[model samples]
Target: MKILQITPFFFPSIGGIENYVYNLSTNLSNKEHKITILTVNTENVQKEEIISEKVSVYRCSLNFRYHKGLISIEFIKRILSANDYDIYHVHIPFPLGLEIAVVASKIHKIPLVVTHHGEYTKGNVFFSLISSIYSKICRNISLKYVDWILFLTSSYSVSLRLNKKIRKKIKIIKTGVDIQRFSATNDGAILRKKYGFTANDKIVLFVGSLSIYNRYKGVDYLIRALHEIRSVNNSVKLLIVGEGKLVSELKELAKELKLEKEVIFATSVSDEELPYCYAMCDVFALPSISGPESFGIVLLEAMASGKPVIASGLPGVNDVVKDGITGYLVEPKNVKQLSQRILKIIKDVKLGKKFGRNSQRVIIEEYQWANIVEEFEELYNNAMCKNGDGGT
Candidate 1:
């Protein structure tokens, strides 16, 4: 099968959607399907690059940004002219590319599978209204053309509250994690020694971008929560991993809260070292304060690392973190609650280990990449058959 994935960004971008598409495409290619990724060009990356014999990528130069839409007329033209695709799988939240994908699928007579990674829930009231309208327009038109619509979680579909006609096309397919790579065996001693973390200190980890645009991640809240946690448990230390525009601001906030000693910002680390960071931590935290976080993939990674998770009780996040079982879910932006949950996991060694064991078991049984690939294969076959596009 020849598959084309339409997305806004691809490899080297380090975003949730970018990582999702890359992993899915590579896994599909490994399954003997020829895959092509159609994405926007970024700095220091080739316009066209071959990842493997079965996988190739084509990038379109981004022209400009227009009110949440990227204007890439040339890219749209190229998409219309591109040929020989058994299926068109588009990862949405890219308004401009989505419009082109709808037209391309129609003209090419290809089976279209649209995956809604989640809606873009950012900005003030005016911008939110505009985003809502844009998302609705794109979603409705794509649904009209698409044969299947994939969602990461059932809660996400319920949140959308689609009409009967559009709801019929919905399919829930969760994203996967590489279980072997993020195992509990990864040595944390190297990082612990390098960072000078003592056995007396309880490590709390938060891994994600720190950009101002991503301030909804609630790193500030985590910092503040750490401050509150320190008043009682001074041994609690924070290891925040990732780099973004808000790095300085978050540092300033930590300093302002007199938490400079408690919080350690590693800024960035290699993929190989990420697992070690998670394995060393007493607990993992994702305090996302927005709806944009459809499914917290980091929760799976942390779970895969055999570490207990403490995350926001948002719709999508709640779907992943099974409260009191896998880990506890605190109300979003409630610094007091977030602090308490973190303390519950880190302070209780026995309970943390139980959650860690449950985490590993869940990933092995449900969230492995291999299992997710098989699901995609089945979905693709079902879509092709339903659209009368199955077979050679």
Candidate 2:
């Protein structure tokens, strides 16, 4: 199958949607499916680069930005000109991309599959009102035309409250993790020593972009919770892995809380070292405070690393982190509860290990990339059949 994946961001831009598109495209390419990624040139990298015999990337010139979305007229033009794809699978929250895909599907009579990552929920009052109105218009039109809509979890699909016709088009497909790369066997000793973290220190890991646009991630809440945890347990350390515009602000917050020594900021971590970062943590936390965080992919990565995890009890996130089995789930932005959950795992070694074991088991049984790719393949075939094209 020749698949064109349209997204707002890709490699060099670290985020959940970017990582999802990268993994999905690469995995499909490995199965001998031709995959072409169409994304904005946010980082001004190569315009067009072939990743493998079956995989390639084409970065469209970015025109500008409107709030959180990147606007690229070049991207829309490219989509209009292209007609050779067997599948047009676009990831959204990208309103322009979805609109163009709807147009392209009509023009070429091709199957269009949309993966709705989440809604836009990070803006002020006026912007939020505008975003809501624009989202409703775009979603109604796109849902009517798209061949299928993939969601990260059934709970998220239910949250949308789509009518019966739209619900029929929904398929629940969770984001996947590279289980082999993020296993328990990967040693974190080098990373620990590099960060001056002694064996006695219990590391609480948080990985995500620290951009102001991503304030919904609730990193400030996590920092405050760490401050609380530190009062009783001086050995507890917060290791934040990722870099963005809000890095300085987060650093200032840590300093203000007198946690300069307790908080370790790893800003220059490479892709190859991410697994080690996960391996070094005693507990992983993602305290996202809003709807934009539909699903937390980092939670899965940490779980695959055989680490106990704690995340907001948001609809999609709760589906990923089982409240009592794989890890605990606290209310979004609850600093006290977040601290208590982290302390529970850190203080009780046996419970933490049990959660870690369950975490690995869940990853092996459900969230492996190979298994996820197979699900996609099946969905693609079904989409083609529905479009009266049979199979590729």
Question: Relative to the unseen true structure, what is the C-alpha lDDT of residue 171 in candidate 2, on a scale of 0 to 100?
Answer: 92
Clashes of 2: 0
Per-residue lDDT of candidate 1, residues 281-309 (tens digit): 99999999987888878899999999999
Measured against the true structure, the TM-scores of the candidates, in listed sequence, are: 0.96, 0.98
What does candidate 2's lDDT look like per residue over 131-215, in tens digits? 7877767677678889999999988778885778878889988778988899999999999999999999999999998877888
Query: How much is 285 displaced in model 1, in angstroms?
Result: 0.5
- Give me the candidate number with maximum TM-score: 2
- How far residue 257's Cα lies from its native spot in candidate 1, in Å, is 0.6
Clash pairs detected, candidate 1 = none
* lDDT of model 2, residue 97: 83
Q: List the RMSD of every prediction in angstroms.
A: 1.5, 1.1
